[model samples]
Structures are given as structure tokens and as C-alpha cells.
Target: MVKLNKKYLKPLKNFYVIGLITFVIWMLFFDAHSWLLHNDLNKDIEALEDEKKYYKNEMKKDKKAIRELSTDEGVEKVARETYYMKKHDEEIYIIEYEDSLLKSKKDE
Candidate 1:
């Protein structure tokens, strides 16, 4: 019985040490505040990834616009609408929607 007890003591002490270390690590690094911080970081990463995807899509649209604007017809269309300029003897018409003209009316 004495020899058996001695044989188990070393293993028991090792397990105790390991358990204590694990507890300390869990308390310091895996507690509620740590978990909340990790979750926040994950959410922030997801939001940034969404922002990146949005910007990538926007970049694609802008690139398409740039390519189109390289053509003469696209340039003329943008200039005519944006600057309200037309060729000689060309008449420009302004169209306004009654619904959009009043912001409060549209909300109701």
C-alpha cells in the first residue's frame, strides 16, 4: 500500500499543477470580458469585410463608367445632362415631378 501511494503521488501532483495553470489561463484569457472583446473583434471584422465588398462593387461600377466615358457618345451624354449644355439651336426642357418637389408630402 505504501509503494502504491508513492507511485500515485507524482502523477497526482502533475495533474494538480496542470489544472491550476489551466484555471489561471481560463480566468485571464477566456473570461466574460475576454469573450465579449473577441466577439466585438469578430463583428468589426465582419463589418470591415462588408465595407470592402461594397467598395469593390463600387469600384467595378466606377470602372465601367470610366470605360463608357472614354467613348464620345457617353461623354456627350454626361456633359449635356450635367452641364445642361446642348448644340447650337437645341432647346432644353426641364421636367419636375410634383411628388418629389415637396419632401413632407412624400413622407406622408
Candidate 2:
């Protein structure tokens, strides 16, 4: 059975080879912080960074809009469009196009 033993145990004959294999296995699976975990954490960090950038950009846009809306004319425009506010005795009629009505029916 020497031939069978030699075939299975040939790599263990070299101390450096055995040490390298052990180190690789330990780093990949047995360590507290494995290579796979590090890779996944890195991806998570990248995704969080992208989300941070998106939120920063959105915050900047919101700040600009807030600054604009602080003015009287900007407030009036937003009030008229969003709340449909009108002066006393003013009449407001909402008109929807045929295509928009068809689109709304299709959506429903």
C-alpha cells in the first residue's frame, strides 16, 4: 500500500507546500475574517458609498429648492400648482386631454 500512501501524501512531503496550503485554507475559510467575508464587506462598503453620494446630491438639490421656495413668488407658484389656490371669486377648471383619459383607463 506504499504506492497508495505515496499518491495521497506526496504534497505533505514538502514542509513549505504543506504550510502554504494550510495558510491558504485558513485565510479562505477558517480565519475569523476570511477572504470571502472581506470581499462581501468591500462590496457593501462600495454600495453604501454610492448611496451616500446619491443622498448628498439629492440633499444639495433640496437645499437649492428650499432656498428658491423661501421667496414670495416661488411660494405663490408652488401654492397655486400644488394646492390649487386661487384668489377670491376666481374660477378654476381642471381639463384632462383625451389621451391622458385613455392612459388613466388603461392603467386602471
Candidate 3:
């Protein structure tokens, strides 16, 4: 048989205090909407917010590029740099160093 000492049972004698303790325990662990669940949800919200911020920054950069590309000079510069394009009279020579060549393959 288990014994309930007077010191231990004193707080349990208060119905309101016992209820408050039980409610706290249940809310923290056992409820469908629990403290742990809320914590995980809050973490997910933070990650999504960070991702949203990153995408917003990328969109701003793209918008700036679009504005620049509105000019013929910008269009030719982007084409020459990105697509390795050249005027009919110009010769394009791509020089790849050994260090740059050995920078690990992409399809791992």
C-alpha cells in the first residue's frame, strides 16, 4: 500500500490548485493543441518567413535586371556574358584554368 504524507497531501487538498496543476500538465503534453505542437508550428513559420524573405530579395534583383535589359547595351552585355555570344566579326575564346576545371563535378 502507498502512504500519502501530510506534507505531500496539503497542496492536493486545495481543489483549485490541483485543477490548475492538472490543466497545465495536460495542456503541455496530452492535449491535441499542445505546447510542443505550438513550438513546432512556430519553428515552421519562422523557416517559411526566412524563405519568403530570400525569394523577395531574388525577385528584387530580377526586377533590377529586367529594367537594365530594357536597353540594347544591357541586352548585348547579358547575351555576351551569359550565353557566350559574340558579334559576327568577333572571335570568342573561353579559357578554363586547371583549378577551375577540377572544382568537383555537378552530377554527383
**lDDT of candidates 1 onward, in order:** 0.88, 0.93, 0.92
- Could you tell me the lDDT of residue 66 within candidate 1? 100
Number of the top TM-score candidate: 2
Q: Write the per-residue lDDT of candidate 2 for residues 1-108, one digit (tens) a residue.
A: 999999989889999999999999999987979999999999999999999999999999999989979999999888888899988999888889999999999999
TM-score of each: 0.62, 0.79, 0.74
Deviation (Å) of 82 in candidate 3:
1.7
Ordered from best to worst lDDT, the candidate numbers read 2, 3, 1
lDDT digits (tens) for residues 1-108 of candidate 3? 135577788888999999999999999999999999999999999999999999999999999999989999999999999999999999999998877777745433
Tens-digit lDDT track of model 1 for 11-80: 6579787899788788768887676678799999999999999999999999999998999999999989
Ranking under TM-score, best-scoring first?
Answer: 2, 3, 1
Worst 10-residue lDDT window, candidate 1: 27-36
